[model samples]
Target: MLLDKSVNHDEVLLRTLAGRNFYASIQTVVKQKSDGQLLLYGIIEDISERKHAEQVINELNETLMKRAQELESVNKELEAFSYSVSHDLRAPLRALDGFSRILLDEYQDRLDDKAKDRLSRIRKAAQTMSGLIDDLLQLSRITRVELTVKPVNLSQLATDIIVELQKEASEHQVSCIIQDNVTALGDAKLLRIVLVNLLGNAWKFTRNTDQAVIEFGVRSSETESTTIYYVRDNGAGFDMAYADKLFKAFQRLHSANEFPGTGIGLATVYRIILKHSGRIWAQSEIGQGACFYFTLGK
Candidate 1:
């Protein structure tokens, strides 16, 4: 075949006489000498190790892809279940709140102080549960929503959220210092939610302080390429022992009586940051202030 110029180079899987399988790369060369004699030369290289390595890598890739698909499917099922349960609970909550309100309105003259207070408590509990359900739905939506990534002005978002918080709690005085031009690449709407919860918590926890100071700023890391954004507040901070539970649903370091919240805000923030492939953490002491730091992944 080499003399006839039928084949120049080829790769083949061959089996030895002992039944051992291997791969080879073969190259053929034909030359004519001045003495009019033809010379045929052939080179064969054993490529079995490289071929085996490639096969193993391909198999591993396939397995990883399958696992990733399975995980995604399970996550979708759990999200659907959460949405259905939350939606179902809202109806009963609404009924409870409505009936309690009706009783308070119609039977106010007939009911005593204790009875009225009990009804009001029932109404309040139901309302709080309803709010929690709403927050759960929002968290679920955050997980499922498609991210529209773009340049987001986080400083502007923090300022806007602070303005809204001030309008709601006009009596509480808070000094907010927002850094200028602190921008990031993320979903603008979702990042806005992050600021809303962080700044709102700062504002809420600082209500009792004589001079409340909340700061939103960014700092560059010398060791890493990511920028660290932070929300710091001189307010009712929390114990560091429970910091690990800060991002879980229904987990609160402070009691509802002390700081009125559904406890899902941080969880929602955590989910949004995870969706952006980022990390969030907090530092605090019992009486000292709290500072939340986060890095958005590139």
Candidate 2:
């Protein structure tokens, strides 16, 4: 190559006499002398350390990609297994409930009060099991569903859920305050589910309160850039000691008799929040009230 007045730089791999390979950065400068002769000046720098670091970063990226793929595959398999098992378990439960109902309806005259009570208990247990199975299936489906993210009007969702709850129990006197124009970026369907569970829990827990009140609103975080949304209710709250178990499946702080539930609603809500890269937590005191706070990822 002909040498010009301009400087040139290049990176290349070099091998030593002992057959050791390394990377080098070379810079060359060319000039013409007064005697009409060309002079060449060059500098070579060993860049082996930089090249090694780059190679390590590339390898780490590849490993992370592989691990992510494996995890996705395993998650899909687990969801499918859970779905199949839940469906299969429903059959036996249905049969148990049906037979117990038949005995109670047709053979009630021949059976004593004690026997009838046992059969009724059996039927009730079967029905509870069926509810648990349905909740499990819902959780499994939510885990695998694809998220279509967009702007969601959370205020409207909470209002709609409250309306439904009121329709279900018209006799219950409850006051609901929903802030207007509270929005978020998330999957509309999944976010709706979150509101339904939170609002539904609030409605149920406040059933016995003399003056029940539920509020849905948002607040800005001084320490963080994201907005914090919350659902607050003046109803039967739980102890803070068991807050750690709040988001777990089948973990209930209260007895079924006090507040009937499948114990999977919060778990489903937790999973949906995680799917949106968000977090959920609650604060409450016994007989006081409860407030659930959450933030969605950007």
Candidate 3:
């Protein structure tokens, strides 16, 4: 029973009975009034189950946090290993490619036409291999490198990239357009690589088109966060049937004879987007055109 206001319970202590036969708590106090009197109140509750549940919850949370840390450590090791392999292998491979060319250049008269042709093919293959290795290294860096996101002027970025791409080769009259003043916070350099690859492909695929058109700009989706920037090109588009395989490493939509590439550019681009915690996808028809959609920022 709860005692009246005359009793004091704040000074109570949880304890057992004097005989140690049952669980209970009590307090003794003296009240001041016209007549001084002593009073006592007792109260108690069983907290064993609540204490056990709290301990269990703490243990489970600790285990989950440890597992998450372990997984993060594993991913770091894997990324480091990948970067090392790509960077280390490229040096000697370049030597092989260069020496082979030197052999052909100095000893052409000592060899037959077929031998010379085979040597040329070897050089081409080695160059392509070197390009593949370089792309892989870039991909690893994109994954492991720390991102310094800052407000970037998309207007200037696109203009500079398009100018450089035009200078890379002058054979094609590529039509370039920047449709919007897209701005966002992200790693400027990585975004440039993404743009270069996308624009390069647009320029490559539209070789057959007399008026090869490639446009870059901002795009909005229904949701605010879903807003993205994209590149669209009028090129020899691929079959929609194999769309899923387009971004996988070493996956190619066209024959090497028809188009020359290591088949890793799109894959690298995909990885960069993923590292930014963004999405990348493509839309294409057999011969119509292709549109590459990618998230540029948060």
Query: In model 2, what lDDT does residue 139 have?
Result: 91
Measure candidate 1: CA RMSD.
4.0
Using lDDT, give the best candidate's number. Answer: 2
Q: Candidate 2: worst 10 consecutive residues by lDDT?
A: 1-10
Q: Report how far off residue 192 is in candidate 1 (Å).
A: 0.9
Cα TM-score per model: 0.76, 0.76, 0.75
Arrange candidates by lDDT, highest first: which order? Answer: 2, 1, 3
TM-score winner between candidates 2 and 3:
2
Evaluation by lDDT, superior candidate among 1 and 2: 2
Model 1, residue 24: distance off in Å is 13
* TM-score (C-alpha) between model 2 and the true structure: 0.76
Model 3: per-residue Cα lDDT over 1-298, one tens digit each: 3334443333332445553332223344433454544354334444545556878999999999999999899888877787687768777777877888898989988988998888888788888888877787787777778888888776678788888878877877988888766876778888888888898898889988878888888776676666678889988998989999999988998998998998888888888788778998899997787999888545
Which sections of candidate 1 miss by over 4 Å?
Answer: 1-73, 220-224
Alpha carbon lDDT of each predicted model: 0.89, 0.91, 0.79
Clashing pairs in 1: none
- Look at candidate 1 and tell me the lDDT of residue 229: 97
